[model samples]
Target chain A: MSTAAATHDDHHDHHHAPTGLKRWLFSTNHKDIGTLYLWFSFAMFLAGGFMAMVIRAELLEPGMQFVDPEFFNQMTTVHGLIMVFGAVMPATVGLANWMIPLMIGAPDMALPRMNNWSFWILPFAFAILIGSVIMSAFGDGNPSAPNFGWTFYAPLSTKYGPDSTDLFILSVHMMGISSIMGAINVVVTVFNMRAPGMTLMKMPLFVWTWLITAFLLIAVIPVLAGAVTMMLTDRHFGTSFFDAAGGGDPVLFQHVFWFFGHPEVYIMILPSFGIVSAIIPAFARKPLFGYASMVYATASIALLSFVVWAHHMFTVGMPLAGTLFFMYMTMLISVPTGVKVFNWVATMWRGSMSFELPMKWAIAFVVLFTCGGLSGLMLAITPVDFQYHDTYFVVAHFHYVLVTGAIFSIFAAAYYWLPKWSGVMPNKTLGELHFWNSLISANLLFFPMHFVGLAGMPRRYADYALQFADYNFWISIGGFWFGLSQLLFLAVAVLCAMKKGEKAAAKPWDGAEGLEWEVPSPAPFHTYDTPPVVK
Target chain B: MSEKQLSVEERNKRTLKKLLIWAVAMFGFAFLMVPFYNVICDITGLNGKTSSTAATDVPEQVVADRTVTVEFITQKGDGISGEFTSETKRVKVHPGEITLVHFYASNPTSTDMITQSIPSVTPGEAARYLHKTQCFCFDQQTLAAGERKDMPMIFYLDPEIPRHINQFTLSYTIFDVTERVAGKNNSVAVN
Candidate 1:
């Protein structure tokens, strides 16, 4: 290992790296590509977040206040699309690019050039998506952006969707290409480039989770591409794949979309599980409890994801047997999910634990993510889902999982690896401020949604009845507060990247493990060009 | 598994090739889901897609001991501004007994409109058992402007329809397809 680092430093000096914007534009280096992906996802996050602000502002009162219903729908649609595809997915991929090679003691991703292509495709894909949104607002009498919720259920998407939907279809196709290529790169890297002694069982949980997540991506992204492509033909080519008039069923759209979509959700979170698994053990100063079980649970969750997609469409007039089957299958996800939550807590049980900035976010993720999971279980009941379907309760459930669960884990990983990535520790005081403000405001933002949703408030509406006004007002306040709190995170990231903090040792966290810590802090421009023997 | 002797570059290439093939297969699989969905629905009688043609499998001896109520309902699908109503709202008959119902549709619009009626049976499991011997839903119906037409459907419930099911609803949704039909006609004329 020591010899590996020594050679890494010499290699860094002699690599003759490309400089300036050219370095990023045509970069094949894993760390540089990882940086590009992270920054792109963050920018998307803010753009999507701005849309959230618009939505919250509009919903701040009962009637339309700022934007019309069409624009409001566009905001909600694009915000969801951006956050899921543009923000969370890319960020996880970025982490994979930066850390997988280091963790597995490999030189780089299997396909370095393809890695560049995957990361590069995302910006253009989002440009088309967001461009459509803009064109909808200003284009010559074209229909407003894909106002059909993120689900873009058929008939609405195929029959009545505006011209922007065509753009949406194209953008989705590009994004699918990017994701599939990225996933292929991951699968190839993990399978081919692991250090000789680093057995599959010995790989870190982050790498293992990512391995599973990549498979899920490969399997489902194409299905999504299929769904959108069908929409494309149905809209322009008049194929009627989803039109009942031509012997097609609208329910088929739900079937296909959720088939991709259910696993797609697991894709967003499995990486988070990996992140939290890494962080919790480090902070608690203990090995993760039930390591083998965690892997099995993740696999089972992924497997179960395929069967439970029908749960999302329970209200779509499925037969009684179908309903019960989906309901039970959806509930079965809880077993694996519960195993993960239990393992995280059990790892912390009676262990010497420290609440660093990263630990704080990890702890929040577990608690809030469990809240999201429990609500998901509630929604899994076919009889009850009829009451909660399409309601704000569903909205609240996902936000708790996504914002607190996935986004929080992203923050945790950022803080945990900031030193390793940037060569400088994030400022302690600023980190604390960011953590506390986000946790509280985020709760304030999402917790009340459950009550409001239960009290008969539907989601995706520009306005609501007067009875829900007070809750809406406070929720908007929390939204703004939570939105502003992320600025502290930005400042911390920028400052750390600028090297404006205390210098970090190779192993900044006392309990941290893996070859990532074996290298110097900031991880060098390149390391492990010659893979280290894992043992 | 046996690639131990191969170089890293070769193994990586092999793996990448396999994954690319898998991705293409899954993409093809997604499209395959359409036909696969139909096959499954046909088998399970799910999604309520009734058979379009006449049924020849009805039992000679009716299930006289068992009688089920069949309710008729009509609704408009998207883009259908035409008026439709079921003449016979409800009927009770023994399984395997032939039953006939009439539905009326009127084109009030100034333009001649072509329409198709899609039939669905409720308690979806009952769909396969409800055989339509003759139905307007079997083909597109062209109604001239200000014309009203009475469409009759002949059907019979299968003798083996689940013993627990005593009643079911046969619903038809009418969709206006004037433009689609016209477009096909124009393309044919051009050819």
Candidate 2:
């Protein structure tokens, strides 16, 4: 260990600050790894967004103009894969890598070498996935991609999957491995490497949330590994895990997958909760209300996640007792989630709140996330789920939680910390403009999906009935606007990175407090060569 | 310094002890998850128990005498295909013999075709079979153009089936396999 540390020190100073392409390829710094994650996530976001637009365009009119049914299925599947794995997860990990050490006053990630390995594995995983999609173009059968949806239900996954399903399986395995490693590093770092005075309770909410999220990741990723492994064996090794012909149950796959998947949804959003908690207080000029309750609430939500897996399979013919159990369990999640929302609002209530870009995004998150939460509650009822299952309603519910709830919080965190990272405050006018457009357009995009879903339109279909055509058209319009609005975000970020914006103070936000704020603006290439004591 | 103040070395030592304890605790916690999962599975009866084995064991002779039904549906909503034959041969049964029936599907399409979909076949019941498998119907098949394929399905009829009826009819439907589209031309052709 000492030799490894010595080698790290020797190379750390002289590493040319890693210039151009090679920096991203062979970098070992936590910040560089974070940057890689962020950039890759953004690229995947665009790719996934593009697929969504195609889906919307096809659904724009009753008839499919742009794509065929099989292709539409592929779009939905890949879009989901990219967004969940490629966009949201990577973005959250990036934020963790960048913020966790700084917030805890650590020099760097506890396992920097492992961090590099985790990031490096992602490109390869995505390459295989993207390559599989490309391979389908030459195949003779459907000329479409894996349309079984991202859940890749058995029978469909096993019997109907593309020839490249093997590749997809391998890709998912690699990504899962990367996530587990990244999560382990986070757990070790937060628990082992905190500076003096930074007790678990005293640690920043972001660190706490990440610690919890890491635990959830470690617990659930292996289940995903198990589920996909079943898929692989069923497909190749003729296993009966999901094969009814051989006495296997297809719905069991749903049980195992969602067991991993439900927590995964929390894993994506929980850190956002931490980010919003941190930002809301700083802007509101108040100490966060019910801080300990907020922690307990987060724990409650994570604990409840395991019991709610069957909620996703409600329509798949679950027994009445099982359905009722899942419904109550899912509803219980809302109590903690509601506590979080109420705390955010209470923290902001009647304080000297200022609407900076980060604050704007945070405020929007509170309102929008609540709306998402309400829809989640609606879906929690077994009877209501019967009406909403597999409909645009489910789509609307998750997009609200994920896009506005999780992704928006990420935007807020990026803006909140941008000055510290780049030495320049992002252009305020453009930032605010981007915020309002995104907030409004995002709502416009996902809010109506509830109605479309309720009106009895199934999700993941290429074409819909004439009744759904109007709503889908409007949704498409909103989606396009939302996609365009992201360009503004990119512009602002690039401008700030190039130092074309206002210079910022080390502590740009007045109410900001933390070891991170005590450091110089734009933080040095290497920060806290000696760890700082936290109070 | 106050009497309560600790020396820097002492503080460092305390921190190290705390960290070591945390590491050990975490490792112990992680180590317990597997056993904990197994316990939960055992309680829930989800410990990968083969559904058939969990139920009363049907005699192999009875399983052999039973006739299984297979139905196929189309993806384009075209319903069943032309006079689809059950892939399994008929079983001979004595009076009052309960036996498992097996069936399968063959796709004869110029293009690679997946059976639209099939419903599950289980044991017992007259019109429908009780499903002991954890999943629904057969795996989707991707047959190449002009390829002949056979997909096998297994099931059993209760002894009561003979009292209620003498013969069973099995049906199947075929559908043109579809492709998955991502963005514009970004598509994955299903095999």
Candidate 3:
């Protein structure tokens, strides 16, 4: 594996990987850690989905039927927290770990040991969080998990909160640390580790999006840490950072939290934007439409995210000036987001389009995510938000974005790259079944939520009024169907891992063009030991 | 090959150092928000976290003959039922003239209780203009069981307060912070 004085072909041998449990415990390999993060995220997804099941089951008949009201509150809180931090974020990082270096022609991440540390810290961090949730539920009078919502509003979270709030705060702190460390590694790698010919513009859209997303992470994650730290001190250390009774304004907490939070929404979706950009062009059998504009659009969206934090607080009675400013700035996000969507559509206009599984998911991503985006634009109107705030409309909007947009892209990425990574092609019928089931049921699950919300059904409630009954029942059915449909994807992934399908070629997708595709199927344990010459 | 490995190691160390520094600095900057808010508010007046000083910034005091009425409203806390009343329901004072008011607090609880009052002015327009040089809200009031205490607040409405705000209500919510500052002596640690 030595590289000095070689003609850049030193990666001819298969390196023997360490066997058994120790391999995962200490392995710094990008592929291994990527797989671990993906699996861990899938498990979290299931956990969050199970919580959703409880929520939907409770909502089925308009009154409390299954769980107690306090437990219902816990389910909502943990569902949002786990899905955001555990499922979506970790899965994105997993893809980045496996694909970023491969796309950029680097042998590995710039900081491999730190990468392992980043991955390892997450399971324990989430353990503390979920443990607190369980303790609150069953600790024989111990306070249940922090139930003031994932935002953990002041006073409700600080003054009246259970002792488990401390655990939630500390767990969030660890999650923030992991995110920052992962971000820094991505930044340094993208900046200093690219192959000689792969200039910033020439790099894949995935790399470009990750570069921006990583910078956003570094800038905002610390603020989130600071916020939770202040919450910790306010709860225990006699600090009145958010205490209204002690001269501190509770509104101040909202200001600081959203400052980090608004950017975080982009941190999750920007990479999906990148993946969509990649998939649309590849399956269209054409060069990307307006690649440079796509890059600029991503950058502008990131920049605009900072100023629009107040849109989330429109219902908090912000000053008219602040409301208008945030309203317009939030509306401004639609422009760049529009350009990205238009670019994807334009890329597929009059080209050799294929409806393969990955493309199917990508196409669904564009349409359904646009549905989410348009609803988001509706939410951006400050006056309109007054009616929609704290309602299922907001819930519907984000699920459309996160589930149909981000999670769909994750599945698309898996299908697009599964052949290359496993050296085995998945069953197409199963893949399509997975896609259609997820797509249709996800809409049924989320779309009716908009109606119930508009009809004044409040969110996070264990029971609903009689008028909201029919939609809730249908939404629950959709929820069950969507939950069951995920098994198809799981089975397909398992079969691919077991080499139960056809042997994949070196370049499985003919239109795929990248340094990754240049490598043989089931990319060797040590790829490009001598970095490939990317032209 | 070993030399190449050494160079990679050195580069990673450099990046790690830079990143660690940035994380620390951001953390520091977050805590700095306490002071930063004050400094920025001083310039922009965006937040009304008014601080009282010995004297007003204006050299000329334009005391007006026109009177403005101020009403006092009190909110009592749980386990802190008390007879909290002002010396009078209303005070009419000329702008920029010092006005003195008295508040009476009685602790009906069997155990000694510590209480804090949070103040806000209605119509909110003259909240910042109504500055109290000495208010019971500036310190926690501890009363023994069945003990009644008289408290005084001395303040002046700034002459520059817009005349449209002719009347304002000064309301305070008395919170039983008996548990918060229970162990601390000298509870008047003003921020």
Candidate with best lDDT = 1
lDDT of 1 at A20: 99
Candidate 1: which stretches are off by over 4 Å? A1-15, A138-142, B109-111, B185-191
lDDT of 3 at A235: 75
DockQ comparisons of all candidates to the true complex: 0.48, 0.06, 0.35
lDDT of 3 at A68: 85
In terms of lDDT, model 3 sits at 0.84
Q: After superposition, how far is residue A16 of candidate 2 from its true place, in Å?
A: 5.3
Model 2: per-residue Cα lDDT over B53-159, one tens digit each: 22244534454454434332222223223234443455554423443443333444455544434342211123332322222234445555555444454444444
Give the DockQ-based CAPRI class for model 1: acceptable
lDDT of 3 by residue, A1-535 (tens): 2332142244223345568987898878888888888989998999888889988999989777988888888889889999999999999999999899899888788888889999999999999989987786676435787677878888788888877888888889999989998899898888767776889999999989999999889888898898888888787677777775666767677878888899999999999998878888888999999999999999999999989997988876454677899999999999999999999999999989988888999999999999999999999998889999989999999999999999999999999988888899988989988988998999999999999888888998899899988898999999999999998988999999998999999888877778889898898876766777766
Candidate 2 per-residue lDDT, tens place, A222-297, comes to 7787777778876766455665434445766777788888999999999999999999999999999999998999
Full candidate order by DockQ, most accurate first: 1, 3, 2
TM-score of chain B of each: 0.91, 0.37, 0.70
Please report the TM-score between candidate 1 and the true structure: 0.96
The reply for model 3, stretches above 4 Å from the true place, is A1-16, A137-141, B1-6, B38-73, B76-79, B83-104, B121-126, B149-156, B162-170, B185-190
Give the range where candidate 3 chain A is weakest over 10 consecutive residues by summed lDDT. A3-12
lDDT of 3 by residue, B1-191 (tens): 45345555466677778878887787777667756654654443344434434334432464666888888887775556888888878988888788789988998778998888777666544666776777888778898999999989888888887778789888777888887776445343224
* TM-score per candidate, chains pooled: 0.96, 0.78, 0.91
* Winner of 1 and 2 under TM-score: 1
C-alpha lDDT of residue B91 in model 1: 98
